[model samples]
Target: MSALPRPAHGPGSRYTARAATTRPRPARDGDVAALARRLTGRDLWLARMLHEHRVLTTHQIARLAYTSARSAQRRLRTLHEHAVLDSFRPLTASGSAPEHYTLGPVGAALLAAHAGLDPTALGWRPTTTGRIAYSPSLGHDLGVNELLTHLAARTHTASGSGLALWLSERSAARRWGDIIRPDAYAHWRDGDPLLPFFLEYDTGSQPPARVEAKLTGYAAFIAATGSRPALLLHTRTASRDQTLRRRLAAAARELDLQVATSSADFTTTDPWGPWWAPLEPTAHRTTLTGLAAHWPHLSPAAGLEPTDADTPLTLPVPPLPPDLGSGS
Candidate 1:
């Protein structure tokens, strides 16, 4: 028999070019103002999100902001047409990668204007989209965003369980880069007693020792700030997870750092469920919320108090968008 051809996933198949649309022209001050007036609150919120997190996939944007995938596509296409967002479809080994959206020049300008600053202050260049599209850390960045976006999307439910605070790598670095540089930081709340954690999304690209060294940084961060947010190391495979769990257990013990680990193999629709295994001899796994009960000594992270140099623009973006009464 002849070899079979692989199936294309959707209209966004890597073989097909994205549907052509009217590209936005160079944005002037008046143009930005006009675009700003045309944008809704949800649009502005998404702009702020992209500015902070760098990029989001079409599916992620849909989950975060829309009632349905079709609605998200329509709104995102319009945003791209207005130059509030720019998208790229990566060539994958198989199937298709969803359109990944980044903050466009006009969107950057809009954010700057809202903050009462020049566009230069935003440090956004015309090359921003291209840079992120080709960056080596693209997968790592996306993995981090994926985990958090799942938590952020929980707000649409009536459970009152969702991300209370989410700081991107850049935002977390700005706060505590000197001591530690977490991949991301977040406060996940199911109800009372929110679980604050620092995510370290591992792709299994680095050696186990290098991964273990990260614990030292967390130890330093705790000592310096007196904050003890749990360190979450999520890896690609079960073997890698086991290897890390064995390698880092003693280090975590010596450093007295609150550490937990999970692998993609164990993940499901509820990432907040009992997928997390603390660095101990026990085989028990716990949900993100259950971690609090596991360790009674756990406390929320500190150092979020604004410094003299901080401005309203420099503050962390809220985890969820403003409720615009549009079911977004």
Candidate 2:
């Protein structure tokens, strides 16, 4: 059997790779070290928290850093000006102020390099747009994961170049009901059946039955929509529950959904963190197209033709949110 292509490890590798590949005068070691040390202890903590969480408002960062909101805001703004971060206007809940702040690709890489044990050996090169940024999760947000799964399903349907389809209530309609509100989503706008991949760094209270129902919903969405988006459910959970696996499979069967499992026994299918986070469009098409195409064959009676790739893998990553206020 052909070896599965490995996922991109993290931003640290990307930076090292870029330095090696670029013809320009390479960034000196002193320069790099200076850049790393330029951050204050508080800044370092704030930066790490933002990169790992992927998105956090100024308020969140202040709370995490145990600093005044003004301090957090200044630190974030400084990071942004230094090209260490980017800001975006996030979609807020009705009647709530919009949350703002997420690490840019470069900022994420710098944080990863600083925090990682062997950043030099990693092959992470930050692309202008196609680059993937990963953050660590706190491992307690089940509700977040549930929403992520739904986002993955949506992404699978939207894999074209430079196009991003988000599923939050502001734009994309809710699938099941109002109760299951998804946060956000994006993918290339190609016609090809995309993979439904979820990335979550947190968890919350979620019942097993709700989880099972979600699996069913995803399966049905894949089957009915005629899109074979591969699903990648990510979390930092310690153990993969057998009950969850069984429920997922039963739901797939009920929905006539053919899922791609790593093992024949329907055990754990994919890794959950930085290891699984680096799949680019080129890598995805080469590594995942065959498996993704299986949906059409498994449910032949359904007569759904697999969607075609609209463009090369490309999508918009929203800007980071702005700082809320000083925590102090």
Q: How far out, in Å, is residue 143 in model 1?
A: 0.5
TM-score per model over all chains: 0.91, 0.33
Across residues 1-328, which tens digit of lDDT does each residue of candidate 2 receive? Answer: 1112224563222212221122233233345456676665555544543443344545544443433656666666666655455544322245543234545444555655764534332232333212221222211222332333333333223444222332332222223232222233333222564433322221324555775566565555555556444443333342333334444665655665443322112212212211231122122212233433433343221211223421111111122222322232
Report the lDDT of model 1 for residue 15. 25
- lDDT of each residue in 47-114, candidate 1, tens digit only: 99999999899998888888888888888888887788877767778887898898887888889889
Where is model 1 more than 4 Å wrong at Cα?
1-29
lDDT of 2: 0.37
Model number with the top lDDT: 1
Q: What's the count of clashing pairs in each model shown?
A: 0, 45
Candidate 1: Cα lDDT at 82: 71
**How high is the lDDT of residue 317 in model 2?**
17
